[model samples]
Target: MHPFVSVVIPAKNEQGNIGLLIKEISEVLHALGNIQFEVVLVNDGSKDNTVIEAKEFAAQSQCQLQVISHEASCGQSTALHTGIFHAKGEWIVTSDADGQNDPADIPALLQAAQQVQTEHFCIAGFRNKRLDTPWVRLQSKIANGIRQRFLNDGVPDSGCGLKVFPKRTFQALPYFDHMHRFLPALIKRINGKIVVCPVNHRNRAVGQSNYTAWSRAWVGVVDMFGVMWLRKRTKLPRIISEEIE
Candidate 1:
């Protein structure tokens, strides 16, 4: 069966969380009733048993689950790219492997995407109340302020893992190391609409964060400048009409 939506999750060492995350996703998608959904879990060279746990859950899962593995650890952006590229669904939903992004919010994002008139669009989740350390939150705030001022993509939380967009829109964007963080800006560069939806955020139940605030900020600053350059050079043509004889 062809899925209407595919949830792509990137995990490195999330053995404890992978099974639970997939179960939650299955429950949520099953409740939607009319929607046909699948889960694509990309195991990014996990040292732990992340793949094993995911496969165990997939055996009993009502939803279709596909597990892809990377021989070596690539970054989250590349794992996301791999999952989305292989996904069968037209609509792709991204979630973190840490189980912080709530599965219940997926329906709302899909609904928002459906409401958009244009085919090229993105629905980014806005985490109004983050459940993280004060220091981490502060760092994120500073980074977001800098990003917003420069990109002006009008997305409040581009870092939020819960996002809904079409696979075609994502494929059209240029692939980069940290392109995942600048999705809103990239979508805008391609003349796509951005919609921000308020979603639930939770503290991590298990496993440490793969990246620190400092690490993210450092790479983010560089990637932000790169996106700015791409934005400046981007020129979208306006086609008036097409005639087929």
Candidate 2:
């Protein structure tokens, strides 16, 4: 039987966090009671023992687990693409492997998505109180402000990795490098609804983050303009009625 939801996590050199995060995910999903779910862990070519640790924990996990690996380190977007495309679930929930995104909040995201009446929608997590360094928080604040102004995506914390949406809705979006960062905007461009939900955030207790503030800022600048172009050119017709013979 296919899983109802698949929690896709992209990890690189997150050995200390992967196993623990998987365990937490399993526990939370099991508590949902009769909600079939699986964890699709995409090891983004980690030089560490992330894959090994994940497999070890999967042995005792209550929910199903699938691990995919890239021969070399691909970016988070590519890892997410790999996992989501391979996931067997109808709904896809993505979370950071750093353990900052609480697995317990998965229920909240799922509940938010369930309440949405639209067939195509995205539930983006809003971190009201970020637990990052002051400098990093400032960078995010500025970047988010600019992105909102340009894309008008209405997502306060688009960088937050915790998001819930249907697998089909995600598959409909055009994929590109760093596409993960602009999900809300892309979804909106394609005429999909966007829902924002507040979720818990925690400080990293394990490995360091892969990308620095400067790196994110530079890439975000280029990606933001690219998305703006895509939005302007995208023309979705409003179908008043459709009848299939």
Candidate 3:
């Protein structure tokens, strides 16, 4: 049997981009013709036609597709959890539903993960040239730097929103509001490894960005501390409570 990969996309209101992204991903993966893949789209309370568009795409695609819905807008992290939990593949890859992450870059990420020779390793896409606004870029750079400095993970683009991990490992992550932004550190808490690959990024063709500068700063403040707490609170087990003679 071919190794299965699940492509998970979390969308809030990305009607314009989701359809094109779906087509592009299908084309690129079909050309590869080696790995079997499925797509799991998480529609996180979209008030737009996003779900309708995704359903249409699913109906037409040769690759298996499924949509998970959230009645209310929880957040991207929650949507990610929903998608991964629904995924039926050995490997899980997540990309922004807004079309910023290009499908052409996935092969490099998968190849890098293979080279590391560890099932515990995650493949992260480090944007070669970020297409987000300057302010968003600054916040991302700051968050990643702070995480790397304190967490020793050396991940420079934790907020890139393009990554791949074993479905089992990803599902094991502790839940949080913005866990998507700190996957590298969360993985490290359990001694997991991550590999970074420079990936292509494109400017959004439609739909306003879901993140705002102020919201980012506020959330960053809380998430940074939360990660620190997780780091400090984690303890290695040193004893066996019982042994059979």
For all predicted structures, in order, the TM-scores are 0.97, 0.96, 0.91
Residue 192 in model 1: shift from native, Å? 0.8
- How would you encode candidate 2's per-residue C-alpha lDDT over 33-108 as one tens digit per residue? 8788889999998999998999888787855889999999889999999999999999999999999999999988
Clashing pairs in 2: none
Locate the minimum summed-lDDT window of 10 residues in model 1.
Answer: 1-10
The global Cα lDDT (0 to 1) of model 3 is 0.83
Go through the candidates in order and give each one's C-alpha lDDT: 0.91, 0.91, 0.83
Show how many residue pairs clash in every candidate, following the order shown: 0, 0, 0
C-alpha positional error of residue 24 in candidate 1 after TM-score superposition, expressed in Å: 0.5
Given candidate 1, what's the lDDT at residue 118? 84
- Displacement of the residue 237 alpha carbon in candidate 2, Å: 1.4
Estimate the lDDT of model 1: 0.91
Query: RMSD (Cα, Å) of candidate 2?
Result: 1.7
Clashes of 2: 0
Q: Which 10 residues in a row give candidate 2 its minimum summed lDDT? A: 1-10
